[model samples]
Target: MIPKINGLGRSFAGVAAYCLHDAPTPDERSPETSERVAWTDTRNLATIRAERAARLMAATAKAAPDLKRLAGGSRGGRKLAKPVLHYSLSWARDETPDRREMSRAVDGSLEALGLDGHEALVVAHEDTRHPHVHVVANRVDPETGKAATLGNSKLRLSRWAEGYEREQGRIRCEERVKNNERRRAGQELVRTPWERPRHWARVRRERMVPGRARRARGPRDEERVDMEAWRRVEAEAWETVADGRWRSLRHLETRAREEWVELHRRQEEMRQRLDRESRTVLGRLRIWRTERSLRELAGAIRGRQDLVEGWREDLDGYHRDERAELGKAHGERAREIERGWHKFYRSRLVEAERRAWAVRETMKERQETRERERGPSIIIPIPRPRQPRGPERGGGGFER
Candidate 1:
């Protein structure tokens, strides 16, 4: 909430110079700001009386676009010349009324200070960090040249502003204005908190124009809600809220929220990507393991096959050798049997011839008188190997 105060003075140029020079630099203006302004109608007054030159210089600066449309003499603290006497006030962002009630409160301040009428203008300024207004007045009154004193305008303005805050009943017009406009946008986003939508809309409404009719629409019966009366109540309530909730922001919450959202999105994306990579790696590993197992199995089968074939070849060679040995044995056995029979027959015949010779010799020898009686008795036995008795026989073993 910006603090604001009003004043009445005679010189536009003098006041402009004072606000610029005598007052603290715009950098230094604060709730402590105490400066003079004028309220006058140049149309009915002389140049010196209205001080149009000074008023014009002070109101030249424009208000920021984001702020509500400026009413009164200056945007933030500018000086412009019009036919009517203008009321100007210096308002701090920390002390100004909520947008919903600013204009009415400013106007109400004028009346409360007994500075109303007299062909008036109200310039509200916002160019500086702490915005303020300048009220340029004609020394010559619209009714008479009798100069109007500022007459406790500051105290009255402050009191009225304070009262508006404490006397609140319904929501402030500005709050309602802001909440209505913001409600839909926040709802659409879904990311915004539910409570914020209505509050933002209320701020939007407060920024809307306040016309000659005050409220944009009228009652059904054509009776108008007295916005001026409403302003009084709001002013009192403003004093309480202004110092408490509307204090300078500790930090910018909006930026923090955006940063959180972006960070969360990045984290989720990384998690998903990691999960996919893990699955792919796992699948590849499974395939590799399976292939390795199959290759090992195939190698084992090939080794077994080779071993079996080698063993079969060895068995066939062994059987062939055994059959050859058997055949040689049979041939040798048949030869041996035949030779034995021949030898037996030859021996028997020799023995029979010996007997016949001996008989003949005996006849002859008898005549020779036993001359052979001294002949040595000679008998020789033939040497022969024993034959195999059974069907099983041993041949010249290894040679066969």
Candidate 2:
């Protein structure tokens, strides 16, 4: 299970609307695609949003007598900038915990983040291959009106998830376990590039618009590029450079090829390692089986056929589990390779498109510069005879 605590937003309505309706904007509303509300502290989404908004407003109101009830009251009297917590818990693609389990996970996450008993909405979405739920919680406690502390929230969630996974008998994330160990030993936790806040923010800025992180992985229809505009730009650039001379994109092609080759080499190395491990395991298993068979034969000669059968059964089960584990590992590796290739090609395509755009801009600029240097064509104005005075029309007679 992977838990992601998204941005702290300011609007409870906005976050609630997003989770309940699955629509960022009113125009994009699709009730059919909206996930069902699995659990909520309030009666309905609208009511919850309104109640939370009211509570927050009252708590933060300038006219309010008791400023101590406001969020962040102890932190030098600063109001909470963002009080809405948008979080998500997603399971592996093949693992779909039922509604009860999902509810428990959501509850545990909220408690871990110090938002237990806070007004929250849990929506379970089944639109994707993986089972995930979106949690929109108000950080301000309705009763105390104090915003929940967010200190070490990420680490807290990670620890909670580790424990939850252990209880569930599945420890799929070794990195989480290692990080927890490091934390206990007073060592700095190792984080990936995307895990760093600054790097994540930069990537989000480059790849998506502000406040649109949810749709960054897959752009919405309206967020997509206008093909007609792109076509016009391409055509104009091509027309300006119609001399049959084109900028070579061989560098991009070569880089892509080299990367692909490197990927293949890595995959081959992994495959070879897997094969060697498989052979070693099989050899050991075979030797053990031979020894077991010899013992079984001796036992059978001593009229201990039942003991021999039990040993054979145990051997068979052990071999079956081992083979199954190896098969699962091989399949996972294959999937990883496939995903790597997909990402590699997609990134190369993006880079090529960017390069092509730069070339087009350069060509357009050159064409414009050439036109400017040629100077404007002179226009000689030809004088036309006046219409013989407009006396017969509406004029005051012919001009002197």
Candidate 3:
């Protein structure tokens, strides 16, 4: 089994829509092979989304309030961030695990990630030859209102998968086995160059082109500029600024300016080195030579160019990974700051509500006291004296 854990996402509804409905194309959707493995609740997509949203809201509402004052106003509650964890498990092309096995694998993987009991929607897709199941789980625990710790989650899942493969008596993946061994020995997991998706794509494309076509294409100069290196430096700078040791955000900004200056200095140094190397290599190539010497020099230049390109690509990949890690760290730090602001706002809101309630109670008590102090006053009805009736119409002159 090959387990691919995707990135942490924000929108539960969006993910649910994609996994349950949007995953299969129209032709594949007619068969309706999507199965809800572990969702005990209603199967309606809208209902599931609403329930999950409500659960997330409840969890966030119950989070403990932090009273620390921050410069920015609290807006974190306006949107949910990184609550969705989507991943998939695929079997070998020849091996088709039954639904029961797939369910077990899903549960096992979730358990490995410390999210077994969390709300998860598992959907099996039969659109491809290889049977695979996609799992979308909420990272936030509904009960405790705490996000599950995801430290070394990839390694943990890989270990679980390895054991699972052994139990199934399947051919073990050598790469995964080596990675597990490395993990056990406290060594960093190393990925081969081709393991990079983009690098692999480039390799595959190159392989597809005919040799004649490739030769005709000639050698095109790749931009020697390393953008990934600059991105890595910038990401590292932000991460450094976001570190907890800083007295305040303002102080962090000041430190960031210093890092920025240092980055520019390094950039200048790199530019000068590139210039010197380019001039030296070009100057040597410009010298006239015999046809044999020319051919030999051409071959040498090509070999050196290939070596340099390979080195550059490898370095770029390393820098890309570094930037990604730094970016993730910076995001976590930013989320922490946002959460602090959120808690602070929640605490302030609660205090305001309490004060308002106390004021209302005080007003009610004063009204009651005033009513009690003023006793009721009695009023007797007073009748006015009746006027003498006017003389009858017929006997006006006579006294009746």
lDDT of 1 by residue, 1-400 (tens): 2234323443455444444333455576433433333222222223433335445423321212112232222223233223223445444445545443555555565567554543333343444666555444332234332334553444455555555554654223354334434432332222345443233322333221112112222222212333343334334433432332222111213433354455445545644543443345453344335446554344334444453344345545654565455435543543443344335434433433444445555666696676666576668988898876433465533442
Whole-model Cα lDDT per candidate? 0.41, 0.59, 0.56
lDDT of 3 by residue, 341-380 (tens): 4454444434444444555566678988998888676799
Where does model 3 exceed 4 Å of error?
24-80, 188-190, 193-400
- Native-to-model Cα distance after best TM-score fit, residue 41 in candidate 2, in Å: 5.8
lDDT value for model 1: 0.41
TM-scores for the candidates: 0.24, 0.42, 0.40
lDDT of residue 99 for candidate 1:
40
Model 2 clash number: 0
Question: Would you list the rank order by TM-score, best first?
Answer: 2, 3, 1
lDDT of each residue in 54-141, candidate 2, tens digit only: 3443343322225344533553446777877788999999896998888889889988988776766677776678888888777666
Cα TM-score of candidate 3: 0.40
Q: Which candidate comes out best when scored by lDDT?
A: 2
Q: Model 1 — which ten-residue stretch has the worst lDDT?
A: 208-217
In candidate 1 the C-alpha lDDT for residue 378 amounts to: 68
